[model samples]
Target: MNRHRLRLVTFDAFGTLFRMREHPALTYQRIAQAHGLKVVSEPDRLKASFQDAYRKQGASNPVFGRLSQGSRPWWKSVVRNTLIGSGCPKADVDGALDPVFAELFDLYAQAAPYEVYPEVVPVLETLRTTVCEDKVPNGMGKGTKFWMGVVSNSDDRTEAILQSLGLAKYFDFVLTAYHFGSEKPGRGIFDEARLLARNCKAEECLHLGDDLERDYNGPKLIGWNSVLIRRNNDHPVPAGVATASSLKAAFADD
Candidate 1:
């Protein structure tokens, strides 16, 4: 892959740039206690409940609703169902659900739950302004320039959340599941992103993400260069796919 010809650098928001500092289930437990709702507080049990509820909620709601429709009812349902699944009585789940959801929502709205990777800022800065020394004739415009973008599977408040984390300024635009009506691993979102980066061809763009299927397969299927950033050393690197241990490593010239 020639960096000189690249015109766009797209990234997956979570894990690639930033990630939740703490599991949300732990926060749910504290919120429930504050609301005077007696519930299971075990980390394992709460995590299981949270996962189940989240999966169920996501499955049932094909499209993530927008903030105009109360900012994703599926999320609220996930919170409510999680409480019930965690041994909170149904009545308590109902009574305390609003406050619990509000607290969690606000918590997420700020940067309290997230931590940006050490190399994120510098990598983004480079990608945002990097320009090729030579011009290419593939309809990629003169002097080969690159723009920074985010194609993330997140809620409508993604821009606001990125702002709170102080990472929004680096992105030219954000394409989110809430706005696209489809999540990653789906062609529609990537298609939308391609249209957004009109100046770049599929091969001239690069997308970096943590999930192999969403970040690698999705973009590869659409002909975009994809890199998998494995922050954790545990997962096996997928065969024939570019893998990086950090954002810095991903963009480092070979």
Candidate 2:
């Protein structure tokens, strides 16, 4: 193991830092009900269907893959597909797509849907000043520098979302899949983050995220250390990979 003390810490946005105050299924259900779609008996079934559709759309969308297309249209497609896949008949889903998209877009773009974790600020504050080595000679001149960043597979509204939640200032920079045109578990997003951390090498950059594949394995493929945050304790930690119940445990002194 290359035990280089990490200097720059990058995080995933959604699960790692901010969490949705309510399950997305609830929102989807509310929207469907408002638009006169038949309510399903089990909300989980609808939620699963919507998630499947969203994931498939995300994978197949060339706009996200190419990073050259506008995010609004891409999200519109996903939301529309979610409605269609949620057992809404095609005619009904089409009828409600426009309004649902408009509302959902605004819902997530603002802060009402999300909440920052209690330990996020303190953990970031500690890591930004405590871990990592000194400055790397910027023309501006600095005595020492440690960086905190965000790398997420989110839409363009991420920065605004962070700002709304008041988590923007703690980061040196934020990179979203919309900006890179690629999602996690792929090398493009992580590689872009590497370029941003010009002062630090891969070994010196540690990434913390909630997903095992995207947050942990993805960065590891690019030579960076990764920490998996199992906030719910739903899964067991795999050997040799770092795991934490919360963000605070991630950087807490042993």
Please tell me which predicted candidate would have the highest TM-score against the true structure: 1
Once model 2 is optimally superposed onto the true structure by TM-score, how far is the C-alpha of residue 189 displaced, in angstroms? 2.3
Worst 10 residues of 2 by lDDT: 132-141
Candidate 1 lDDT for residue 106 = 76
- Where is model 2 more than 4 Å wrong at Cα? 1-5, 62-69, 131-143
Residue-wise C-alpha lDDT for candidate 1, range 1-254, written one tens digit per residue:
66667777889998899988878787888877888888766889899998998887666665545533435466788788888888888987898788888888778778888999999998777776677655555455555566678999888778888999899998878999888878888888877776787745788788899999999998999888999899887878757989899999987873
Pairs in clash, predicted candidate 1 = none
* CA shift of 17, model 1, Å: 0.7
lDDT (tens digit, per residue) of candidate 2 on 106-216: 888899998899999887676666533333433212334556789998878999999998889888899998777778989887777877876567877788999999999
All candidates' TM-scores?
0.92, 0.87
Candidate whose lDDT is highest: 1
